[model samples]
Target: MQDTYLHHNHQEKHLKSSELLTDIVIGMSDGLTVPFALAAGLSGAVSNTSLIVVAGIAEIAAGSIAMGLGGYLAGKTEQDHYNSELKIEYDEIETKTEVEKEEVRIFFREWGFSKELQDKAVEEICKDKDRWVEFMMKHELGLDKPDPKRASKSAFNIGLSYVMGGLIPLSPYFFVANSEDALKVSVGVTLICLFVFGYFKSKMTGVNPVIGGLKVMMIGAAAAAAAFAIAKVIDGK
Candidate 1:
């Protein structure tokens, strides 16, 4: 039992780490891409690095807030959906006790429990209303209780990640006086980061890291190139 508990705990911790990594990937991918594209577009049209820097910063701020809010909403939605299902489970257990009991027995039966053991397990489990409903929720409905702080935590993680990723391409503008020069440096830096970020993200999610990295780099490069080309065309007019 002690070893089982330890193993479960380890699994839970691993799941949380995976969730955090997913959030980072969500924020960082957009952060690096959007600002890099914006700077590239502006660099083609404008001569002043300061303007690009200001625009990039503004974009980062807005993107972070937007992404954070999106994460928060998604977390809240998960919590709300779980709570609603939990209430339904409780109601079913209360108003339809016999049916609920049979369902529990059926679940155990499917799990390879013998007839006598299923009866004994259902009786013991049904003795506690809370435990019974929780079991049903897990087994029948297949929903887990969402962490109460999931929303706030997701918001913070995504927002912070967006800021960090957005800064990479923008940093060059702050150092260089010319937009074109800053863009050249930004392209190199952001491309490298996109590749590295994608490699690790893929590895974490059990994908081909090298292929993932190259794909991400190509996508970012393509986006920036297209944005720059369009901006140059517009500026030429």
Candidate 2:
């Protein structure tokens, strides 16, 4: 029994990792695509090295804050929903203890429990309020309590990943920012990064990474083209 319990807990640790991995892919993908788009657009508009540097800096700062806030809000919203559901469950158990007991018995019945055994299980589990609530949440609502700290950490991870991803496209511009040469380099780097990022996400999600990557690459290219076209028209005046 000790070995089984230990193994179960050990397995749970691995499951928790899935959440962070998902956050990483999402964060890094944002970091790469967005800044790349911004850099490409600005690079087209002006060939000034100082201007590019300023734009890159601005994007890094603004984008990080924006991504972080978005992630934080999303996590908080999910947490709030879970808390509300939990409250409702608690209230149900509080006001209708007998009804809750019957529900638990029925649930275990489906698991092939005899009425005698089910009764004992229900009685023992309901003895603790915390344990009872947690059990109901898992069995009935299929949810868990949201940890504010975990959510906040996930948000931070996402933002940090975006910054890391965004750096890929921005790096080349500084090294070759003197002439229009840098813009092309940035575009080249951005497309490659987009494909790699897409592949990683696809692998995780079981999607076609090649197609996903190409689609992402096309989006970047289109954004850059539109920006360049606009700049050309503006310059014509």
User: Best candidate, lDDT-wise?
Assistant: 1
Judged by TM-score, which candidate is best? 1
Give the alpha carbon lDDT tens digit for every residue of 52-160 in model 2: 7778778888888888888888888889888898888899899999998888888999999998999999999999988998999989888877777766887788888
Query: For model 2, which pairs clash?
Result: 31-162, 31-165, 31-166, 32-165
Model 1 lDDT on a 0 to 1 scale: 0.92
User: What TM-score, computed on C-alpha atoms, does each candidate reach?
Assistant: 0.90, 0.81
Name the weakest run of 10 consecutive residues (lDDT summed) in model 1. 10-19
Model 2, global lDDT: 0.79
lDDT of each: 0.92, 0.79
Decoy 1 TM-score against native: 0.90
lDDT digits (tens) for residues 168-214 of candidate 1: 99999999999898889999999999999989887776679999999
Q: What RMSD value applies to candidate 2? A: 4.7
Clashing pairs in 1: none
Error of 1 at 176 (Å): 1.1
